[model samples]
Each structure stands twice: as structure tokens, then as C-alpha cells.
Target: MNLNSKIEMQNSRSSSEICYENFMIFNSQRAGFTIVELMVTLVILAITLGAVYTTFIAQQRSFVTQDQITESQTESKIAFNILTKDLRNAGFAYPVYSNPPTFSGSVVPSENNNAGRDALTLVSGSQQVATLAQPLIIGQNIISITYTGSARFNLTDMANISIDGIDFSVITTCSFIGIGTDCDDNFVLTLNRGMNKPIPAGRPLYALTASTYCIVTDVTDTDNYLDLRRIAGIATLASCSGALPADVERVAENIEDIQFAYAIDSDADGLVDDQNANGVFDPGDYLTPPLPANSKILAVRVSILATTGKDDPSIEPSTKPYYSSGITLENNITDVSNDKQRRNIWSMEVALRNPR
Candidate 1:
């Protein structure tokens, strides 16, 4: 009883002490979060990430929209300015031509429409010309001119001559200006290019060039960006549109459509000559018409539509058509597959300073 029982009791006491120590260590180590707490943290992190992403997307959309609108406005302004400058010079013949430039060449206003878009063909007689000193009748080639001017003339520069609206040149155009002595003669002009009519003295003469402006889409492009295109300084309008001439250039891109309407001064009242069927000459009650070919056009109203070439994926822009200055562009051929892209129309009125 003394040694055996005492030893057994000692062993039991040691085991109990070890068990107590382990229990205490376990309780101290279990001081972590519960499942619910961990879940709450994850939820907060997800919400923060989602908010940041949403803000980023919104800012990106705004950037795209603003950029596109600014681009369209810039292009429209450039095109309109160029067109106005050219049109104003329609009849301004540096030397003056018997046949000065006119609003429309020969075709009717109906024919001016190509592919549902307006086609503008105008002659530019506002070129420099050598002045004549002597009056030459029909079939006469030798004509005297002032020998000297601000710009000296070269024999190789002999291309075409116009006076009183008549063009004189051979197939190769005027071969050369032979020096001669005649009535105030500085130089003599020789021509075989069909000068069948009589010419008076002291006439304005210059070279000839024809220009036409229109809208077109190129063949190689996947997206027909409805660009503003032109056939610059060709011999005739017939050679211009059948196939784009080598000199054709794009003035502005993303121009959906361009239109022009002539202001006819039929009544000659000088106030836009608004010929309303109501017979009341009211303000803004203007008219667009079958203006006589080669007749006089006092004013021209031009409408242009432009767009952002791409769409904003995040924004839903307006689907309605553009309206401004009595010009309404309905569901035209803008090729807006999605309403995300922005588009607008601008209108302008330009007066023809020189009319043929």
C-alpha cells in the first residue's frame, strides 16, 4: 500500500496537470474571427471594387462623346468656309470672261441631285488673264495685249483665254502669245481653240477650270464615312463623277450628306426673292427651285451633316434627326448602326458676288 499506491497517485496527478495545460493553450489560440465576420469583409471589398469600376466606365463614355462632337464641328466649319470662298468667286474673272461662272452650269436642278445627295457644279472664271488692246472679230487669232503686268506671261503658259465670256483655244489650247504691235499692243494672242465670235477691245481674259463638290464613300473602306469630296479644276463636269478623277480630294470625313438650294431673285426685289405660293413676301418663307441654268443666283443655302465615325458603347444618344436653319435632315444615310454615335447638321447662306 505504501510504494505502489503512492506511485500510481503521482502518475495520475502528472497526467491531469498535462491535460489542463493543453486546454488552456487551445483556448488562447482560438481568438480569431467567426465565419460571419469573414463574410462581411469580403462583401465590403466587392462593393468598393464595383463602385470604382462603374465610375471609370462613366468617365470613359463622357470622354468619347465629347471628342466625337468636337471633331464633327471642326470638320463642318472647314468645309463650309472653303465652299463659301469658292462660291463667292464664281463670276470674278481676273481678266473677265464673256462667259463668267454661273450658279448651275447647264443641267436642271433635278439633275443636280446624285444618289439622294445634292451635287454642286460651278464654273470658276475668276482666273488671271492678259488684257487685250485691240478688238478682234470672229475667226481672228492675232490679238494685242498689254506687254507688262504685275506677273509676266510665258509662252509655255498659253492654255486658254476668255473675254466677254467666250473661250478661245485650240485643241492644245492657245499655242503661244506672239509679240506684236497693234492698238496699245504689248503682245498678241494667237488661238485656234474655236473663237468664232467677235471680241471687243479691252476685255478680261484668263485660263479656265471647273470644280464640282459632292459626297461619296470610297471602295476600299469598310465603313463609308460619308466624306465631303470634290473634283477640283477639271476641264468639264462630264469627266468628274462617272469615275472619281485622279485629282479628286476629300475635304472632310464623316460628312453624312451635303445639300444646296439656289436662291432665285425672280422678282428682283433684292430681299431673297421669296416666291411663296401664298403671294405674301414674308420673312423666312423662301424658295428653292428649278433655277434657270446659267441664270443669276443671288444666294445659296447649304446644309451639311457630320458625325463621329465611331459609336459610344455606353451612351444611348438621340435617335431623332437634325434640324437647323429651316433645314431638316431626317433618317438619312448616316450609317449609324447604333444610336451611340452623335451627329449634327449645320446650315449656311452664301451670296454669289460674281454671277455669269
Candidate 2:
């Protein structure tokens, strides 16, 4: 063998070996992605999933908030409707006297002043004073109504009395005659002792004249025994005074606030008189110059505040302001905290049944 031939054979062998090694390396490289590429792909997938999850959560929260608001609004509307209906029917039979008698004989100055009006004086038929012509005395349900009279004391011919001693003042054109017959004459005035009223054994006769007084402040106390006796009028439970007629009830246990604002026709002109003089009807403000003697309440605004969860969850902006500005209850004159709470609030407005 020659030296040149041997050299060429060795070179060819080395070249072959190099080519085999390169082929193996190229195949391995093409078989899979780099670690960096794999990591990037995983990161992109995580981001996409995270965005989708976050969007779902946001939508869920929005739905919850909307549901709560709807529930609150519905409850408030129902409560207001009930209250307005009863108030419109208040003092239905009695002629709205300009000089309505107060327990102190002092005229009730403001229509919103319920101190005496709410505390009805029950004058039994036996207590009716024939000489005075007053249907109620002791032992009777003396429901003093402030209704608009006929031509004798229509809205046009009446004036609001502003005297200090007079809670309700009126200047009438003639003897005020209410709608239909006298409300006092139509209904039978009987003494109704609340469920709490003690019944004497062996005596069908309940105490007609007792110093004891039955007090009702809220709807919960409006049971059959505590219910205000409806004069000659509708027989349905809806006609009874207060909110519920012993059937429907409040749902949430955390309810903290329930407020009322009355829309009154101060001048009996069949128009709501906004005390703030804003011309827009708002129930929160007291009737300007107070409700006239013969005026009627036309509408009501109700507000309720409640908590959802058992414990307050430390929500942001925990407290909310009143729904409407320049409108508030009589007790809220200084402190507007009626609706202040740790959880939620519901508010609404309603119109009364009958109004002058």
C-alpha cells in the first residue's frame, strides 16, 4: 500500500464519524422545544385562565348587588303602600274640624304631631254627650279625622290657623260638613280592650272607663287586641290601621331602620304641600304651616335599613347617606342617622287611597 492511499482512507473514516455525530445532535434538537419556550407557553395559559376567573367573579358580585337592591326596593314599596292606605282612611267618618279638640284643649298645631291623634279617646255610646253633640266621650273610640268638608268647608274656602296654641287652625266658610253622612254617627263606638286587656271572669262587660291606657307604637304591636277599631267602612284586613293585617311580616332578622315621610295637602287644595317649598313632593319634610284642620295626607315615603350577613364584613364606605336630599323625618331634624347601619338600606314612596 502507498503512503498517500493510507492517508486518504483515514481522512474519509474521520469525516464519516463526524457526520454521524452531527446527525444525532440535530435529531435531538428537533425532537422537542427548549425549556424557555415551554415555560413561556405555560405562563400564557395561566394568564388567560386567571383573566377568565376574575371576570366571572366580577359578574357574580354585580349580580349579588343588584339582587339586594331589588329586594330592598320591593320591601320598601310594600310597606309604604300599606301605611299610605291606612293614613288616607284615617278619620274617615269624622268631619275634619278646624278646631279639633285636643286632650289639653290646645289645638294640634302640626298635622305631623301624632301625640294626641294617635292616642284615640274611646267614647262609648253611653258616654256620648247629648248636649255637646260630640259623639265620643269616655269609653268610645274617638277617632279625630281631618278630612276635607263639602261646600261648607271645601279646600278653597279654608285657611290654616297659625296661632301658637292651635296645633290645627282653620277659618271655615260655614258649618263644615264631611263627605256622606257623619262618620261619627255611622260607626258603633265601643270600647275595645287590646289582647293585653284583662278580661274579667263571669262578666261579659269589659271595663268601659278605666284609667289604664293601651299604647301602640309599631306594627308589631298591631295585633287583634291592639288593632285600632275601624269605624263604619271596609271590612277587609287592609282597612285596619298599621302595616300588616296579622298576615304578612318582615323577612330579615337584621332589619334596623324603618322610617316614614308623609305627603300632605296642607291647604286641602288636593295638592301635596312640600314644606321645603321646593315644589317637588317629598314625604320627609313636615307639612308647611302644618296640615290644615281639614287637609288630608295623600302619600307616604318609607325607608328601611337592614344587615344581610350575621356579622358585618367590613365593607368599604360602610355608611350611606339619605336617598333624597332636603327630605327627612320629624325626629331626623338634627340627626339624619335613621337609616345609618352596618349593612343595607331600602327606601320607597307611595300615594294614599283617599285625599282631598
* Best candidate according to TM-score: 1
| TM-score versus the correct structure, for each prediction | 0.63, 0.38
Global lDDT of model 2: 0.37
lDDT of 1: 0.59
Task: Compose the digit string of candidate 1's lDDT tens values, residues 88-142.
Answer: 7765442233432322342123224433566676556556556667887776777
Clashes of 1: 9
Root mean square deviation (Cα) for candidate 1: 9.1
Q: Which numbered prediction scores highest in lDDT against the true structure? A: 1
What C-alpha lDDT, on a 0 to 100 scale, does residue 255 get in candidate 2?
A: 36
The alpha-carbon deviation from the true structure for residue 176 of candidate 2, after best TM-score superposition, in angstroms, is: 42
What C-alpha lDDT values do all the predictions have?
A: 0.59, 0.37
Expressed as tens digits, the lDDT of each residue in 6-99 for candidate 2 is 9999999999999999999999889989899999999999999999999998888767766665665564455444433444443322223422
Model 1 spans with C-alpha error above 4 angstroms: 1-31, 94-97, 100-111, 125-158, 162-189, 192-206, 235-246, 267-272, 277-286, 292-294, 313-340
Q: In the order shown, what is each candidate's alpha-carbon RMSD? A: 9.1, 16.9
